[model samples]
Target chain A: MSWEIIKQSLPMFQQGFLLTLYLSLIGIIGSIIVGIICSLVEYFKIPVLNKILKVYIEISRNTPLLIQLFFLYYAFPAMGIKMSAQLCGIIGLIFLGGSYMSAGFSGGFNGVNKKQVESGKAIGLSRWQLARYVIFPQGFALSIPALAANIIFLIKETSIFTVIAIPELTNTALDLIGLYYNSNEYLFVLVVAYAIILIPLSIILTLLERRVRYGTFGN
Target chain B: MAHSGINVLFEGTNLTRLLLGMWTTFKIAAVAIIIGLIIGIILGILRTFHNPILRFVLRIYLEFFRIVPTVVLLFLFYYILPRQMNLHMPGTQVAMLVFSLWVAAEMSDIVRGALISVPIHQKESGLAIGLNKFQLYRYVLVPQAVQLELPATINLITRVIKTTSLLMLISVMDVVNIGQQIVEANNQKYPTGVFWIYGLIFLLYFLIDYPLSWWAGRLEKKRLEQTNGE
Candidate 1:
């Protein structure tokens, strides 16, 4: 309610916000790579790798990301594979985001027209070339909206890293509240900060979805 | 390396503790889902009503709830609400409130999508056959939209169950919290118990969620086939 508390807390919140941004950026990129690899594994039916990826995807998608973070942060250390909370959190997000993105990308991959694949073959395009040139383009275009949604979800999921004490935005807010016992003031600012980032992202995603739905692509 | 902690989860009260945690998880998730379904149906039906201001407000409500992390929402409702409003309540109750709000937002979207997907001619034909607006909705639109929305609602049910894990973060002593406690308690007894405990929790969630999701998918496919046939 008061601007004084907000003024005092601004620096901490800003730092936390930047850390969240950094984590989300890394998560988004890493997960996209993971997603593409998953889709490729599925597309080619890569023997043992495909089966492993399917189980990974199933486990990641079904279980809560909180438990996943706990497994990586708490369980790994118990097994003597120690890592920083930030690293574990980001890795968790990547795995989680990748699993969700795999679903979207597979839907897009299946949507690539059969005739298009036939035409590529008729043109003597090799299997790799057919996938790289003809298939990836249309598949990615078809899947852009779902991909954006996954990115947004990943960004939100980064908030869970606070559980492992990663000092993200939510953690920073809680820390401030702990220090000042000003839950109402700090929590309001916290929600606003999240909304400030998320609302614009959601709007952009909405526009992107509309464009993709209208068949606007690399034309 | 051998897992010295293998017996931590399987031995004695450890398994009982984990089961109790699962019971709490199931209990809370069930309450939240049922309450959420009722609230969601009402909100969803409200969303279908023709009012611009109401629609705009509902849009903002849905967008805000959908965008905010469940963890944050849990903190706000469980921690901040009591502080801000001077209305103290149990964490479990606050969790139910926050999650029901979330489920309602998600469910409204599902219902809205289903309503939109229903063919316009179906409604028109009902009107032409002398059905009043109430009769049109009751007899024609509601049935079809509910059918279309069923699988998505079931999907949301799985989501609701999964999200109940967040309650642990708020100190609600759900399955994850109980698992963590068990691991911590026995960490000294068997230094590698964390892996087994969390892995079991992960498997527990998978066992619960996978079948529901599979059923949702199957229902969706069946609905698709029926529509295609029609």
Candidate 2:
């Protein structure tokens, strides 16, 4: 409960905070890309790719992210393919978040009315144009709330990267605990740091979800 | 060059140890899910009551659990409580508490949604028949909510089971911990077997979870069809 020790560990915490942000940014971008690609593969019903994605999503969704991280960080090295823990942790997070996001995005895609797609076809738009103009926007709108919720889950899951010795927020707090022998103080700051980053995103998500629900994905 | 993966399991008590760990995983997850769902059903009912202060407090409780990472909560209970508050519990028990609280948060949300979705006219009709609050809920609301909540609650069971993997991080002897132990013991002789060993861990989880997920989907579809027909 000493402020002096907590102050001394502030620099370490700052560094960890930065790494957490970096990891989450990569996770968000990678998951969105992976999610969109998976959805597209499903939407078009690409035979081989869709089958692969089905298996990927099934396994990814069913397993815990921690075990998935172990597979990449610990298992791959045994197979003669070594990766840095940071690299493996981020990749694991992407795969974990991406599977869930793909499911959410596909829900949004399916929410697009069938008649709207038929009308788009009647308008003689190319399939690519049809998706780009008609489907993607509507689907993205419908998915905003689900996407936000998934992002929040992803943010919380990022804390698990510490188990792999990545110096994310949680690990940094643990490190500080070791150095300062004050688990209470360090974990307090750690919780605050995570909340500061997450709460605003959640608020924005709720607002956006409400707006979208009211049928005003504004022009 | 690595040793044979099959030999690692048959090499004395390794397989027995792993199966025991798997049993522990199931035991802890089952206890947590049941307790969480029971607590959640109560809170969910409370959440729908027309009391602003009660609803507000419930929201805070749910949001706090949802916002915190599971690992942090586990640490707070497993490490901090013992050291600071002199509240010591076994690692497995702590894991159960952490997960049960999380599951309760999730279950409460599901329950609230199902409860709210019950038609308003049903409640009105119950009141017209001179039913008390207890009788109304027992006869009308709880039954309807169960139909809506069953599939989502099944899905939550799969989630709780998968989350038990996190217990390994806290040094609980769950299946993943056993996998790690096997890898550590055999690292020198059978380095390549890490792939198969972890793959086996993945398959074990998939066996437990995939069927539940499939069943949940089927239940959800049936519920939807029933509602549509009605």
Error of 1 at A70 (Å): 1.2
Model 1 alpha-carbon miss at residue B93, Å: 0.4
* Chain A superposition TM-score, candidate 2: 0.92
Over A32-143, each residue of candidate 1 has an lDDT whose tens digit, in order, gives 9999899999998889999999989888888998898988898898778999999998889998999888878987876676778889999999989998999899998888
Q: State the displacement of the C-alpha of residue B118, model 1, in Å, after optimal TM-score superposition.
A: 1.0
Cα lDDT tens digits for candidate 2, B92-184:
999888888889888998999999999999999999999999999999999999989999899889988988888986789988889888988
Poorly placed runs, candidate 1 (over 4 Å):
A112-134, A216-219, B1-3, B222-230
Q: What residue runs in model 2 are displaced by over 4 Å at the alpha carbon?
A: A113-134, A216-219, B223-230
True contacts kept of 1: 0.86
Each candidate: RMSD: 2.7, 2.4
